[model samples]
Target: MSDFLVVGGGVIGMMTTLQLADAGHSVTLLERGRCGREASWAGGGIVSPLYPWRYTAPISRLSGWSEGYYPELALRLYEETGVDPEYRQKGLLYLRVEDEARAMAWAREVGKPLERVSADFLYAKEPEVAPGCQEALWMPTLGSIRNPRLTRALHARLSAMQGVTLREECEVRGFRQAGGRVTAVETSQGPVAADQVLVCGGAWAAALLEEVGITLPVRPVKGQMILFKAPPGLVNRVVLMDGRYVIPRADGRVLAGSTLEDAGFDKTVSGEARESLWASATRIVPALADCLVEHHWAGLRPGSPDGVPFIGAVPGLENLHVNAGHYRNGLVLAPAATRLMVDELLGRAPILDPAPYALEGRLAGGL
Candidate 1:
């Protein structure tokens, strides 16, 4: 048995386990299903939040800190694991933006570059985008990644690392507590003893905590996404209109995501979502209509109130910690959140302030 046990083998779980093992700690990751196939894989890997200015300060801080780290992280992961995460910085263009002023103001506040481009410039920059897009916000620095690939890279890295165990299809039953500390985890396979345990269970985190008398508001919010098979260079960059987005991949296929539905743990893809997303995506880039939709899927996002994840020690439990409830930004926030939790767990200085992600108020404001 490892000294550290991390529940939930999503991106958050795998990344944290990798970091702890890299720091010479024995860590084991438990996943109910496959690693990274849940919310982590479900999200469209947009590095920046959907709307930059709208999110709270905690999100901004973690996102800002992680944004700069992705390029380096992506490169290093590629170098070491040989799995290209396809991290691109072609920029995200927001068409028919509702609040350019708020976006620009927030950009200025955060020292991020946000530009307003004319229709002519928009058409010229991304020829695929439909013309006459009134006004658009061109966020140059932000871009996207191949989420499936990133999880593969993390999984590959952890597999190579010593003292790290990646257990898939391992559903955690509960925890064994000695006094207030978690001594072992009761998993589907069997009880795995550990000095400390961290729950990174994504949408299923709350139920796991409930067994140990720790009720946290981490419910499931189903997000549906679609894939369009187009040429590689058809869509140049990430395009957003309203709440829908189109993320172009290195290959010919492009990813058009995501519907925010509060469907509890139901990952069932719907025809309603398909028609709605198809209509929304085609509006932004009319050219996508010419291509065939390759696939459609859904993921259960761990919806916490205000969309801020709870990332610290669980109340009344000394060795138990949580790093779930990332809502929609699990992939975007994984690196920094993992680092923060690793630092705190290892008694090192934190990467960012930990107050905003505390468990105090979030538990009361249940989902």
Candidate 2:
């Protein structure tokens, strides 16, 4: 069995570690703070390819495959760790106000049971939705998982694994690379050696890689989201309108998000952003206007120049790999990215092609 060290404890890192451990490899996960408390927890939990029709074929395939995996994975994790991931298949509704022809054509090509619903029909289905809103595309294939529960479930399951060790509150200072291979990692506690190292730090990857003379063109894209305490049946499906979304949680909380900002490590929840999100939520669903604000949070998505995740081995280092830069879709893309990373490490064919998201492609594109 191989002894592998995975840096970062977000969803990507946790999923990667679980995959490696399942493959009979010894995996150690090091987290700088509370595991999964970063972007993975902060995401809106919209489990789609994000503009599914616009994503490259390979990226779309990865997301589609991962979406199929969530149901079974959720069950297995819940059974193993006794922690429910809160996987929900409530579906996604995308409001289309412009480019109706293009939207219909693209929907036809994807063949995901897309249907144009009238405003009255939408209101009939989701009574809480605002009547002023126009038509929307009903995408029934979409689903979501409670991100925080998934992270906690993964962490618990990995902790129970015989070959997996999770070192929480351990901040990685730098890497020790020699002969083009990362030999060990320097952390706050001390040095830990492993046969292979995987850098899965989310928004903080670029900074971490810079310490080792490698520059990952990953930047922090801040997203601000707000939550409202609504009834469980307040909104039956995920609704997207005016470039904002309202996702209904299983626990009677409605998630309204988000503002994309190019802020670096600044996770402050701004009042203006919150107000804008609240306004958008109210516009989409008038009932949210009367709902009480439960919480608000901001997270930095690790955005790559091309807006695709960085998977597979890092260049100039054979045993060192990268699985970061997932941006806004980290939670949605975690399973597939982890599966591909494990497959590559084991010299097996990946679940999906890694070319589009390879580190070399990022360099060639001048990102």
Candidate 3:
């Protein structure tokens, strides 16, 4: 039997599986669709948590711990799998920020580099931004990764690793519990009995937990994004304005995202979202209006209250755990979330405090 059975093959699940394997545990990773096809693949792969100052302290801590490890992790993945995750530390320029004092205080507290850019400096850096931008907050240490490439690299690496079983297209139907533990996972194919289990099912995690009478508040929040085929260096890095931002790829592709909608369990892109995102993109960089809107799509983020993720053990279930509810920050938060999960499972002191992320006090009714 596999030592651990992990439900969900998105970034969180995949990263958890890898970390467990690194700790010398045999893991069987099950995915509903092809691994990494969900929000993990659909995301723009911004290394920073979206609007970092706006998130809670737990999120900030997790992201802060994860940020320093990306460059090395990306390089390691590339070295092992020959797939470059395209981790680039370009920077992010903030426009129309509502709370400069709050942003400054947060930046100072975290020791993050924040620079106030003059209009001349900001426009010179990204000349296409909308006019009348007086000043901007610049964080040069911020970075990005190509999501598809990172997932691909992880998939390849996981497949190559010993004590790891990668099962794509295997849908976990439910969990079979006995004596305060999940004995096996009932899957579309058959019953997969592992010594332990983890539900990292992203948006679909809540339903899976409900099967065992555990009501976690991890629900699906829909976000839509539009991709543009633009010239390289057109946007000059990442630009944020009024909850919408454009990410420039090393190649000539610029990604504009996204809308926080209450649309549940829906991954369908919309004409309305396209127009809105296109408007946002062009407003930031007018040149994008001329570029081809190559692709438009949507992904379901695992949304939790206050943007805090639920990570760690299910209260009564001894062998089953979870690492979901990251909302829109999964890509940036996965490294630390999964790392700390491994530490918890292995009974080691994690780099960051795992208390705030545990399902104990964070959840409302479920215990």
Candidate 4:
């Protein structure tokens, strides 16, 4: 029996397991399918939440902590696993500012650098942007990471660790509890004993916890993305307008996305969504109208009631914990969330105020 069993293989689950193992805990991670191919892989890899000011205070704090930690973590992953997640500070450009005053106020409140650029400056920085996009707010410290590569690196690093076991295609059917503690997890293969269990099942997390009588309030939020194969340096930075974004990858692929729908675990790519995303992309950067559509796909983000993920011990269950319901900011919030979970599980002083993300507090009508 391992000391810990992490259910779900998304970036959060993988990173949590890796940290536990690094701290000398015997950790085993179970994934229903291949790890990291879910929302973690489908995301645009932006390290910060788009328009961070729009989110709640908890999200802002977690994102701020992660923003500073990602570069060091990315470098360490490359050094250990020889896989660069391509973490880069390409900056994020908000092409249209509907509430400029509010955005400026939030930026100043958070101490984030926000600069207003004129049409000439915007054109000089990105010539492909449509002429209609005359002004923008540039956040120069924004960054992105190739999420798939980062997940792979974490998988590899965990596999190389001594006490970490990764079981792909091993679905946890249910849990076996004794008294108030979870004793073991029943999987398709067999039962695996665990001293503690963490449910990081992403979109499927709610159903899993429901079986144990825990109402996680997590639902699947479907987001569709369209990929365009363009020349390198076509879109130099991440461009955002009306909550839709065009992210430039290191491999010369421009990713334009996405549409958030409460489609109940349905990850279908619709023609209408494609048209809308393509139109949005072309509207922001007119030159992208000529780029070939490389791929169209959808992923299920774990949506919570208030956009804050539940990241503490489960009430009424002593040994069971949760770190799911990240909604759209899983990639951006992974590092800080992982740290918080580690601190909570190890009984150490939390780096940030844990009350904002506590599961018990959320259950008791706390934000």
Candidate 3 residue 216 Cα shift, in angstroms, is 0.6
- Candidate achieving higher TM-score, 1 or 2: 1
What does candidate 3's lDDT look like per residue over 1-367, in tens digits?
Answer: 9989899999999999988899899999999999999999999999988688888889999999889999999999999999999998989999999998999999999899998889999988888888899999999999999999999999999999999998888888888878998888998889999888889999999999989887888788899999999988787689999989999888979999999888888788889889999999999989898999999999998988777788899999899899999988999999999999888888899989889889987667431
Q: How far off is residue 153 in model 4, in Å? A: 1.0
- Which of the two candidates, 2 or 3, achieves a greater lDDT against the reference? 3
Let me know the TM-score candidate 1 reaches against the reference structure.
0.98
Q: After superposition, how far is residue 251 of candidate 2 from its true place, in Å?
A: 2.2
Off by over 4 Å in 2: 364-367
Which scores higher on TM-score, 2 or 3? 3
Q: What's the CA error at residue 1 for candidate 2, in Å?
A: 11
TM-score of 3: 0.98
Clashing pairs in 2: none
Query: What local lDDT score does residue 111 receive in model 4, on the 0 to 100 scale?
Result: 97
User: Against the hidden true structure, what lDDT does model 1 obtain?
Assistant: 0.88
Collision count of model 2: 0
Model 4: per-residue Cα lDDT over 1-367, one tens digit each: 8999999999999999988998899999999999999999999999998888889999999999999988998999999999998998978888777988888999999899998988888888888886776688989999999888999999889989999999999988998988998898999979988888999999999889987898788889999999999999889999898888899988889999899898897888999999999999999888889899999999999998888999989999999999998999999999999899989998889999999888875764422
Give candidate 1's error at residue 309 in angstroms.
0.7
RMSD (Cα, Å) for all candidates, in order, is 1.0, 1.6, 1.4, 1.4
Of candidate 1, the 10-residue stretch with the lowest lDDT total is 358-367
Q: What tens digits encode model 1's per-residue C-alpha lDDT throughout 1-367?
A: 7889999988899889988988899998889888888888888999988997999999999898888888988888899999999999999888888788898899889899999988877888788787767667888888688889999999989889889988899888878888888888988999998888899998999999999898888789999999999988888889999888899998878888889898777789999999999998898889999999999999899888888889999999998999988888888888899999999999999989898888876687655
Winner on TM-score (2 vs 4): 4
